[model samples]
Target: MTSIVSLPIVIPLATAAGMLLVRRNILLQRVIGVVGSAALLAAAIKLLYVCYTEGIQVLQLGTWPAPFGISLVCDVFSGIMLVLAGIMSLTTSLYAVADIERRRTAFGFYSLLHILMMGICGAFLTGDLFNLYVWFEVMLIASFVLIALGGEKPQMEGAIKYVALNLIASMILVAAVGLVYGLTGSLNMADVAVHLRDVRQEGVVLGIAILFMAAFGIKAAVFPVFFWLPASYHTPPAAISAVFAGLLTKVGVYALIRTFTLIFTENPQLTHAALVVIAAATMLSGVLGAAVQMDFRRVLSFHIISQIGYMVLGLALFTPLAIAGAVFYILHHIIVKANLFFVSGVVHRLRGTYDLKKLGGLYATHVWLGVLFMIPAMSLAGIPPLSGFWAKLAIIRSGLEIEAYWVVGVALFVGLLTLYSMTKIWAEAFWKEPASPGPIGYASTSGLGWMVVPIVLLAAITVAIGLGAEPAFEVATKAGQELVNPQIYIDAVLGGRQ
Candidate 1:
């Protein structure tokens, strides 16, 4: 049972080792990759069940105590994130196996994908700040390789900017960690929270918070720091891009939530005000940018920034319901956003280009594809009877309760803008008639069951979550409570913090 804490890392590390051994055996490599991802998914589910039945679990590596040894803590928040990461990795692995053209590099790709997942899981589960930094580096290196895998010109270009910006962010993150360690004499998050309660340094704490925010802001694709995302995200293959889009930014947001809720809770009045302003600007700018985009993938990429604002907005509200809504929104966005990108991959495979001008009237020829795309897109746009609507309702309800009229107004406005942008894609791609009818000129591939399977599965999950909101909301509420009350997590890690 103690070893279960490491299953997330173990599965991926083992898969990477196996891939290296069977580099020449393509079928074996694929099988190993899928098996590894499936195993991780199972582990995540089991972990969630453990959280529900037995409460929070903490594992200290090597049996050493906290503030001395590495610790992994699983609260409801970490459990939910684990589950979401597993689902995305599993589905994306399936898509990559079938859709990727470079077979020789496929093993390497899966290895990197698993490595990224390992880092994400580690980051979420770990209770130490410095350990989280190490995981971020792991995630970054793997992402660099994944983005640049094809050696294409655009991918290379995007990878360069991505790596450069992320490297700088990493450095800033480390410097912030050093400052926090210097101030608190500890690298463990639980320890830092306890220390901060006694020591007071207004300027230093705010400065460290700002540094941390800047580093995570770049990673989260917030407002001014978001240009790199739109520029780089569309360059990768859809499978790669979908997973990156779905998971990477959310990790940054997760860090923000964890850090603020635990360590920085001392001054929410100041932090919340700043976060609310940032959230509003991020929402407006992202949607406005999406409205002008001509490429389908690019449009969705910009909307990622906009939708992230909603999640951050929930955090800014600083209420239980709002926080729960943010948690639920993150889960919803991961599935819907990834599925949309996969649908774009299918459309690109069928129609030859991602430009809206070049794509039209797919509804007539490919009704299934149209329907598949519509479900997630409409859900994203906050149409009723979908998962997106519930998330929005929760956030807005919280905002109104807190008398955050401005934030609520911006959220409503962003929701409408989201609808408009999605409708633009629908009008251009599916509804409008294309210039030519039979056999669009892209890479016409026949058995695309692997690609379609994941998309359909995610789409179904999206609808299921929408219809089954009660249970999902319960999980999210539990996660939110755990986040707000960090003592349970701290105690689990440090043998009961004071």
Candidate 2:
């Protein structure tokens, strides 16, 4: 099981090194990228199955005991994330085959993609704060390179803001880790949780908690700190944007959920209450901002911030069902959001523009494309019989259960606004006739089969999860149960050592 837990990180890191060596052969690079990501998907599925049946899997490096050695731990929550990382990695890698130019591909794009996935896997699996920071740095380096791969003017501009804000986040995260170590005398999260139980520095602990929140809030792109997301997300190639949309900020959200539930439980009233306010603000601001954007990708980017609020709201509500909904939402949003970006890329390939006013008649020209776009778009808007519908229901129902009517009202209104934004895209991009007379700007679909495959597969998953949600819901419920009860994780990480 420990070996299985390590496979998600190990597979990608190895593939990245392999890809770097074969960087000149574009054919080989694509093969390696696709095959490697596919292999990772298999490994992640295996890990999920193993963890589900056998419980949390842990690996202590160099055979060192808990709290002394680096540990890789995979519980139900981490398992779910690992599975998501695998699916997105494969899909984005496939999209990159067609979307990325050969010049960019030759310059180590495949390598960087694997490295980014490795970092995400490591972040999900690490059992200690120090390594978590290390994984964050790894992700930052890979993502910075990937975003700035082609050196386009907009890419560089976006990269600057992205890197600058993230560096600040890294500094704060490092500072928080140092504070936690100084206060608890442990870098291992489970061990720190145990020590904090006996520590008497309540005020200091609370302050450190706030520091963590701010640092991760920036990474998660919540509320006022989220400007960097829309500024940068639309700058990269759609494949890059899709992967980032799917995985990056969610890593921060995952960290927040893990730490708050496992290690920072003492100040729920202070911390969680603050999270509730932040969540509502993030949702309203994101959706409202999206409602006004005319560019295809930019609108999707802003909505990322809005949908993040729903997941955060789940964590903020801090109920078993709310947390479960948050988990389900993570899965649903990753698929739908990434697919939407992929669809944007496909539209750009066909129409040569992302401007809504300049683009139209997709439905008439490419009916299949229109259908693909709507599956995820409608799901994202939380329409019935789609994955997003269930995900939203979980969070809203949990809010209802707790009788937090104000946030619930805010959430429901935001859903309506999200639908409005989706409708705007539908009307402008697909519904209306093309701006020009006949055959305005359709590109050849030659060699685009790979790109279309992933979009269709992801859209199918969105529908399947909606119609057959019980299994996913059960997994989410079990995951939320583990999150709400920290003893399972603590014991897995530090059974009798402490």
Candidate 3:
């Protein structure tokens, strides 16, 4: 039997290569894409089971010893992230098959999609800082191509700004890596973490930390670095945008959490305080921005920033429960955010416009689509009995436990604003009367099954996570413990070597 350890990266890379070979055959391309994603999903589920049964699994690639060759480590956090990325990619593949008109363009899209997944999975699993940076580039380059693939004016404009900003962020990240390498004489994350503990140059450490924050913050779409998201996200095809919304920013947040917990612990006071302020600003600014957006997708884009604040708040608190909450929130947000974007795609396919003012009466024509949209929207708004509610509850409860009164207040206020914004989308897109008496483009009666299947699956997973919170929370907590300790991770990466 093949080891489950390397499948995440291997499957995607092999599949991308296969697609490249068969790029001229449209049917084969789609088959390769769907099969690859399905294989990835299966592998992720198996990895999750392995993690549950056997604990964290670490694989040093090429059978090389740790800290000498590249290593991939899987724990609860990376395992769950792998599954989420797989789900998003799988669903988006189905939606693309049904929605994309240009078949040739789709081959490239799917190719990039697989490469992007490989990057995300590698970033999550890698134990080396330089490898993580390489994965980050993989993600950024693929995203730039994906965003610009459509060749529309809006996509072109958005891709330009996106490319420029992300390039700058990447450069800063490289500089940080160089600085850390020069300081510690190692590029391995665990090695750096161990060395960082004894270093006394607070000023230099703070500077490097800030560089990382700025770089990852841009990728994650946090405040002050978040302008590009709303302006460009709505321009892509719904399926492409859905995948990006679901997986890309979360990668950055994941990096931030990993670095802070593993390597930057020496300056907790400065690091935590800075993250706290950013978290508060991220929440307030994101929600308020969402509240004013009339475009359905744009509103959701802004909410991504707001919800990210909750995750970062958990990190800033730096408590066990808070870190677990952040993990849970990331899992919750991935599913809910992607499904919400998928719903937007469904609406666009049926109604021919994403403008909320021009959309209405969807509930009457497409009852099931309305229900699908409602599941994620309500979840995103943090309604009870859903995953989003528990995620928010975890963060807010952690905040209160730590006496972060202002963070708690800001979180609650953001929740209310989130609800308001969700309601606006619901009322404008579903409840009100349609502008035209006749049915819209697709009539909402046909070609929707493909779209709704994925949304329904994601929503079901959200509910399942909430209802089965104990195990998931346990996994998240374990992941947090590993991160907070850093010894096991560092040893796994660097131990038994000269």
Best by lDDT: 2
Q: Which pairs of residues collide in candidate 1?
A: none
TM-score of each: 0.98, 0.99, 0.96
- Least accurate stretch of 10 residues (summed lDDT) in model 1? 98-107
After superposing candidate 2 on the true structure, give the runs of residues whose Cα lies further than 4 Å from its correct spot. Answer: 437-442
* Cα lDDT tens digits for candidate 3, 143-193: 888888869899999998888988898899999999999888887787788
User: How much is 14 displaced in model 2, in angstroms?
Assistant: 0.6
Residue-wise C-alpha lDDT for candidate 2, range 1-498, written one tens digit per residue: 377788999999999999989989999999999999999999999999888888988999878888999999999999999999999999999999999989999999999999999999999999999999999999999999999999999999999999999999999999999999999889999999999999998999999999999999999999889999999999998999999999999999999999999999998999999999999999999999998899999999999999999999999999999999999999999999999999999998887778898888899888999899999999999999999999999999999998999999999999999999998999999999778844446565756787899999999999999999999999999999999999999999887877
Q: Whole-model Cα lDDT per candidate?
A: 0.89, 0.94, 0.85
CA error at residue 30 for candidate 3, angstroms: 1.5
How good is model 3 by TM-score?
0.96
Identify the superior model by TM-score, candidate 2 or candidate 3: 2
lDDT of 1 by residue, 402-455 (tens): 999988999999999999999999999999988676545656766588899999
> Of the candidates shown, which would achieve the greatest TM-score relative to the real structure?
2
| Candidate 1: Cα lDDT at 2 | 71
* Candidate 3, poorest ten consecutive residues by summed lDDT: 438-447
Off by over 4 Å in 1: 103-107, 438-441
> How far off is residue 140 in model 1, in Å?
0.4
